[model samples]
Target: MKAKVYVTLKPSVLDPQGKAIKHSVELLGFSGISDIRQGKYFEIAIEGPLNVDQAREEAVRMAHDVLSNPIIEDFRVEIEE
Candidate 1:
């Protein structure tokens, strides 16, 4: 099974990196840009003996425990068999 994870900062949090990118975009002459946000993308491939539901459960657990901090970050999981 394969899992694709997307991790991103919460809307209430400030992202300096995203701000910098937005500034750069403006400097590069991109107009009408109201806001910018940044996020992380992860693709994980798991092997052996697990059903799709089991894999999704395990991936969500990992996202909460290892991949993301539930306080400042949020994550979404996409499962493929």
Candidate 2:
């Protein structure tokens, strides 16, 4: 089984990095971008006899506890088998 986790900052939080990227993009001649947000992606390989549900549960727990900061970030998990 494999798990994919996407961690992102909350909407209320300021994203200086994202803003810098957006500025760079505009400087590169890309236009019409209203906003940008920075985030983290993690791919975890589960090596066990766990089923899809179990893997999803484990991934969600790990995402919530270890992969993201609950105070300023949110995360979602996906499982593949």
Candidate 3:
């Protein structure tokens, strides 16, 4: 089984890296770019059974424990059988 986790800042949070990228895009002549956000993608391979609920729990726990700072970020999990 595999899990793909995407960790991103909440909409209320500010992403300086994303802002910088947006600025660069504008400088390069890309018009009407309103916003951008930076995030992390983690692909994990597991040896356990494909229990979606269990995997989601584990993934959320992992996100809280190590993958992200709960104070500033949020995470979503995608599990593959």
Q: Give the top-scoring candidate (TM-score).
A: 2
lDDT of 3: 0.89
lDDT string, candidate 1, 1-81, tens digits: 899999999999999999999999999999999989999988999999999999999999999999998899999999998
Give candidate 3's error at residue 69 in angstroms. 0.7
Give per-residue CA lDDT, model 2, range 1-81, as digits (tens): 789999999999999999999999999999999998999999999997899998999999999989999999999898878
Residue pairs clashing, model 1:
none
Which of candidates 2 and 3 reaches a greater lDDT?
2
Q: Which portions of model 2 show Cα errors greater than 4 Å?
A: none
Candidate lDDT values, in order: 0.94, 0.94, 0.89
Which of the two, 1 or 3, has more TM-score?
1
Candidate 3 Cα deviation (angstroms), residue 38: 0.5
Q: What TM-score does candidate 1 reach? A: 0.91
Give the RMSD in angstroms, all C-alphas superposed, for model 3: 1.4
Clashes of each: 0, 0, 0
Could you tell me the lDDT of residue 9 within candidate 2?
A: 99
Query: How does residue 23 of candidate 3 score in lDDT?
Result: 94
Task: Write the residue-wise lDDT of candidate 3 on 1-81 in tens digits.
Answer: 788999999889989999999999999999988998999999988775648888878887898889998899999989888
Q: Compared to the true structure, candidate 2 yields what TM-score? A: 0.97
